[model samples]
Target: MTTATRVPADPWPAPRASGPVRAVVRVPGSKSGTNRALILAAAADGVSRLRGALRSRDTLLMAGALRTLGVGVDTEPSPGATGADWVVRGGLGHGDGGPVAVDCGNAGTVARFTPALAALTRADTRFDGDPQMRERPLTPLLDALRQLGAVIDGDAMPFTIHGKGRVPGGSVTVDASGSSQLISGLLLAAPGYDRGVEVSHVGGRLPSGPYLDMTVTDLRAAGATVEATPASTGRPPVWRVAPGPLRAHDRAIEPDLNSAAPFLAAAVATGGEVLIPDWPEVTTQPGRMLPALLEQMGAHAERTPAGMRVRAGDGLHGLDADLGDVGEAAPVLTALAVLADSPSRLRGIAHLRLHETDRLAALADQLGRLGADITVTEDGLAIRPAPLRGARLDPLADHRLAMTYAVVGLAVPGVTVDDIATTGKTVPEFPAMWAAMLAGPHLASDNTG
Candidate 1:
């Protein structure tokens, strides 16, 4: 995700806590999941309803993008409604629709991933976005699009796709080590192409492997044939998607477990308890590693029928591990590290520089403001728990950064989060939800039923 950012006028002063924190949070749908569902539903053989879909900036932008391309999208509750349902009349494969313009709006899913889908249409489509999007990694996916027979005007953001109403997709190889969206964006729309697609990763470590797995899992469930040579099998990765009719059906989107990080971490940081409902026993989401992460941080975790319940231990211990697979949780992890009783080291997350913000650098700067003993590492960070003091902090418009600091505010005092509204990117009602989770007032919760 990329955008030209500015300091918001009203910076939010994160609430200081008086005691142990307890709250039950039902996070909205996964931005990743909702966008993927919208894409799949758009190409399906019939109308599909997405229940429990996350309606936020990213997903809404995706829906808006699909709509501009002539996909029928209707929200049961309302547009941009959190925990909302969607009815989409699709089966309108690309290129047949009229010309369209897409505003990527700092969403990586929309920025790097949609060009391949756009190429499948015989429409004059233009893709444009904010300033930061121009600097994001998109060439890998765009180049792959060109090889697959789509006429593209530029190598990166602000490009145009001249859709032929049909793609002669066959085989394309790309090194998606920097970003998995390159591979996923191509594969998601591959089934619409005449010959389908065979995508092979050239080499090296693929950041966020679990996310790619999630994409593949959902793709298969939608009736597309997907075959892959696992990276763990000592071979380069490759995905073969068969051209076919996508099965349209109603599916309940899962809770955004990644967004559950901060609320869950508040438990670990404050020696309190927090429960995130509807935690899937089996999931491809990398956030599934949270329980393990909680244990490593010296927290007690219980898996019950309701959801995952976590409580802090007598003290937090440091950890040394690679977090590349679960990069989205890095901010929350860093916040915990700053308050741990011992030193901690997190490695294998350098790729975070390419995220919505330069996460690693942003974390370093923000944590520094909070007075943490943080040392920036080339691939990750090292921290020695210190007496953190509250201070005004800017997340640079990064939602993860904003939430991470809010977790810190639970244990510290007078911490403020600038541009807190930026959290609307994924969780629209985050501030309200967090406020509800606090002790004095009320707990803001969403009931899926």
Candidate 2:
């Protein structure tokens, strides 16, 4: 396996595109898919092989967390395989594995998903993360776990799960408005519970429906019976998982469509075209809406044999979008909005406030400093096109922000992203990929699988 370049401590002077760019970018497998697959595989019966699993900080953290709980997660590729293959040997019995501490490292999947797994172990599992992750929401998930008969201490990070070796799982209602991962966490770990679990979302608004759908699909693939009901006009969404044996199933993870957002954005920003090879014919990822979103922004998006191809249209224009389900893609889409010709209103993404950083505030403050007409609304951002100038951007160690700044840099020179290394959180080779896209032609990616 090729190791990614060591990220520098200084600001990254994002390279500018001299003209319209035409390139092919192959991003790593989905972080969401990889993490969920690891968790499912770890909780399954027998050994499973995961091909094209993302090898990034988040997925690594998840593997480490499962390993801490006595599950075997091997990262050795099989013979003739291209990229990394995670071989997970399941059968984590209800043993008193004593005490262990898991470092979440600002990965939402690590922070949100691991707690339920911890609830199944007889270990005194304590979960904590970086300073910023300490501020992200966990109470809703923690409280729901408590309802499922897991003894947990602390409201957020630095919390401990005192498991009695098995969770007395039952129905629990969670306010999952802040994050869909909260609900996914419970569902992923539900099969191991004594009574399985039935989760209901009775919060303000359940965000990221596609992510929840992704979770259900993975669970069903593992032979666990799952029933999901979407929210209606007055009824909240509910998910039910029946206790059963989860069979190990080897599969290839899809390329991260969310990670491909900025590359597509580069095409729109530069009046160029970029092809993302290996785009899945169908996916539950929220980023599946990226091509449609870009098309609305005056970009032509077409799916080919290679993958999804996005090319600049006649001109870039502002968009009025409700990004509730795909809020994670908002940062990169926001980059496109600022450069558009008209005003843009992005609503239904208030939950972004609790992500890696206060993304909404960060976007407003940073873009405002860059002379862009941007405002932080109650739910989203209101941006108007203006003359943007290059400036040093602070991503606050947020990976999305780092990529967002890089997209802006393609159009506006002198843009530097502080802590550009933070992109390692999801896209380990983001800087390299950005450089390759700027150079044009077929771009190399970390995963050739």
Candidate 3:
């Protein structure tokens, strides 16, 4: 077992809002979309351009891994293009060399998605990540690959995929109850396999359904023929991909809606309004459920010309919701629920135990330290209205937990977050963005540009 070094930093005193906070926030491009696009682009037939992709730690790791596999991921903005544009030149047949190392860091996308990509190359690729990553389950995906004729050593992080320059892809059943990423990773690399791929889920209810939808959507956008069917009588859900060429194309990534959770929840917590510009009118991202969830929590959510606007409603209230489909939203929602007038029951998210940290355990421990009534149920969290106090909270190096701390700190003064730097995993400028949102009552950008 590789023991990860625990980096320590001074506690960040989370800023408290005096009154209603009003701002217009523009978050960075989607981390999910950026990483997924990077994978697809690396497998594309020609050069691919990605405009407005997130320049965060996770996306950077994905880009770096692709480059290690002999793919071209460069920063060459078009003649008139603005912001960050990544030009990927594909056509690298699997591995370019042997004995390569891929650092997955703490990004689940890199941990789960890159292994399949590594199997397509004829190189010795070793995948590893932070200490916490070594605990995440990769057996299902690895076993599925093994069934498809891939040589893999080890069942989790710090494993090696001995690429034979090709994968004899065929039908394989995976119990992806742990994560939907396990499924998306296989489909992203399926188009390049010798016989294509067919993935069937034979596990508990799949978590993060929207992420799977996003995968299929991105694959089709690249002109890859993918067919997905839900579970029928006496059958499991299946996704089939035909071996074909993935065309290179330019695409604009949507803003990270998941990143918007804290800011929007901030508005509800402080009895204010936040207008998030460039919010997609239609998106398959799980964060799309935010508006409806916010409305249920006594916040008014609507779409505007600028973007989605969420305003404080009558008052914050607890909610009973099954977050199996949107586990990403649970952390922030848990923070908000603690401040509600009643108790909240957030269920259907057992897989959260396998994330960067056991989010449920962390939430329960940290929130309880702050004098909140929080309990970890079998499948989710039960939070009751309680008086919260300022305390030094540990996010355990989880980005989402750091953001959750920020949301709780908005209404509860004197609270500080430890290891706040973890937010760099996705939103690199989360601290600055959080400070700016509380600095004034005017329209502002999160500096995603």
The global C-alpha lDDT for each of the candidates, from Candidate 1 onward, is: 0.84, 0.89, 0.89
Poorest 10 consecutive residues by lDDT, candidate 1: 440-449
Q: Which lDDT tens digits does candidate 2 get at residues 1-449? A: 11123344778899888998779888888999999999999888799999988888889999998889889998986454324889999977556776899989889999998889888788999898888888888999999998899999898789999878888899999999889999999999999999999999996878888999999999999999999987788888889999988999899988899999999999999998899989999899999999999999999999988899998999999999999999989999899999999999999999999888889999999977789999999999999989989998888778999999999999998898888888998898789889988887743332352
Whole-model lDDT for model 2 versus the true structure? Answer: 0.89
Top-TM-score candidate index? 3
Q: Per-residue CA lDDT of candidate 3, range 140-175, in tens?
A: 999999998899998877899998888889999999
In candidate 2, where is summed lDDT lowest over 10 consecutive residues?
Answer: 1-10
Off by over 4 Å in 2: 1-8, 78-83, 442-449
TM-score of each: 0.94, 0.95, 0.96
Better of 1 and 2 by lDDT: 2
Please give the lDDT score at residue 202 for candidate 3.
94
RMSD, every candidate, angstroms: 3.5, 4.6, 3.2
lDDT tens readout by residue for model 1, 10-46: 7788876667777777788888888988889988878
lDDT of 1 at 324: 88
Which order, best to worst by TM-score?
A: 3, 2, 1
